[model samples]
Target: MPKSLVNYRVRHAFLVSYLLIVCTAAVLGASQLQTDPGSITVRFIIFGVIALILMVVGAIMGAVSKKRSASDIGEWNYRKSLLSIREYEKVLGRHEEDFKVFYDDTSSAGGCCCTISAAYLLYLALGIIPEGGIDASFWFTPAATLFIIIGYALLGLTSYGIGQHSVTFGVGDFFVAPDYRGLKHAKMLEDEEALYVKSLVKIGTQDDLQALFETEWRVYLDGQPDTVYIQLKVDKAHIYDYPYLVGIIVNGPDVVERTENLDIDTRFPGIVEYMSDEGVSVLVSRFDIPSDSAELEHEPNITAQEFRKLAKALARRLIKLSTE
Candidate 1:
């Protein structure tokens, strides 16, 4: 599963908006107390305004998430894209493995909860000494009530959003996995844990990766936020071409097909757009078995040094596309 970065980010954005509303409301309430002190209208009007603004911002972010990618976020450029990979047992009870955890922000919930609690305490203190106050609890009672009402509201919204995103990311992993199970090829793509991390690429935090057919796909992301992993649904039946060596920009699905050809939906944003804009193409041939077993050779006609040189060329291309 790809990191639920998009949903997490949306949830995080919603949390920030909630915070803004809380802080703004708290400050306004304090100001009102200093002036007239008895007025309760400030909570409604100012908060209403803030809510409106947040709604507008949310709409814009929705558009961005739907149309653009997560890499556009300035903070994401230098950070690692994905945090960890989880097995189905670690996540939902999926039967397969190969999905990864992309993004999560449950950590932020603790911060929000603490902030709400502190704000309530602060308001309670100020209200305890309010004018015309008689009973001690009576003075602080309004403050506590106000803060709890607002605080719980904010905290609840944030928590729900966070959970919703977590569930969304978890489920999406399975959606693509069915298309990919038992489809990966090439021994070089495996990581130390043999998890095959590089096969997945992320375009941005907005959209999730669509699972195409299983094939040999190489991923090249170095955890820079500016880099968004573009995802495309690979067809169940198609050939593909990928970079292997420097000068050998195009390689064979030769183990199977007569010619290497990569067919990606260039009309879309993520990988296809990035590849088209950069003139990069990944080629794969049909996975047909060669009748002559002896002729089914997979080695390239190049020396070790030459192979390294060829790989460097593709590496440079990958780096450029990755950053772009």
Candidate 2:
């Protein structure tokens, strides 16, 4: 049989055993009450209620196990193994805080489940003792209680094992933050707010390159706090009317001399209005070249050498901005 089916069967069997034991105990207790006219009716009532509770709990747990199994199978069928690591990293990055919460919650749940299940198993075992036989027997009650506690501890560990595997396979918990701090930090030149420039070489189609740019920008933007100002200086690269390389300079709120795009000069007012509506102090300018040719000479294509230079410049700028 398949692994999922096997797991389902095992869980079902455990629950069935638990329910059967409780039901059998209830039946035996009820029988004893009928025979002995002096028997305590309260004892029978208490046992019956306890048994019913266990049966219900077991049934609910069984349902949850089955549902989890089905989800695992579906994910197994749909998921690709090659990208598993990348996906895991992506999840960690995007939902760092959420993952922490999930880990803590599941661990606590596992511990409680183990402890409670053990206690119930002990209760069932102790029920086997005749009421009048040995009222003060220390051996059976203590031993049974110990065994139940240990058994549930082991069961909880098993549950955790199942959860870990399920999460790894993209089956169990999928909780994570929508925007991860890692991506933001990756693009960051320094810890403080300041201006930074980064350039991307685009050898592919404009659409493909643009997609990459958007992905990077979105991740960075999402990581920032709402109070920060973000500005983007865009340098468009064109090859036969098709845009290629795009250089970007990101500046924070303190930057002076507002940059303008010649191509869409008229659109700036609308863009500013949109940003205001969205509660973001950010703007993306079109490719702009000044009449003075000295600026072009200074801001040349960003090579590996240029990147190092920019990193240092960004660091210095951040220091100045923070101190100010």
lDDT tens digits by residue: candidate 1, 26-91: 566445534533434433332344333433343344334322223222222111223123331222
Residue 272 CA displacement from its true place in model 2, Å: 36
Task: Flag regions of model 2 displaced more than 4 Å.
Answer: 1-109, 121-192, 195-324
> Lowest summed-lDDT stretch of 10 residues in model 2?
204-213
Off by over 4 Å in 1: 1-25, 46-324
After the best TM-score superposition of candidate 1, give how far the Cα of residue 286 lies from its true spot, in angstroms.
32
* Deviation of model 1 at 74, angstroms: 20
Q: Candidate 1's error at 229, in angstroms?
A: 38
Write candidate 2's Cα lDDT for 134-188 as tens digits. Answer: 2424332444334333433343334433343233223344422222332333244
Clashes in predicted model 1: 28
Candidate 2 at residue 68, lDDT? 46
Model 1 TM: 0.26
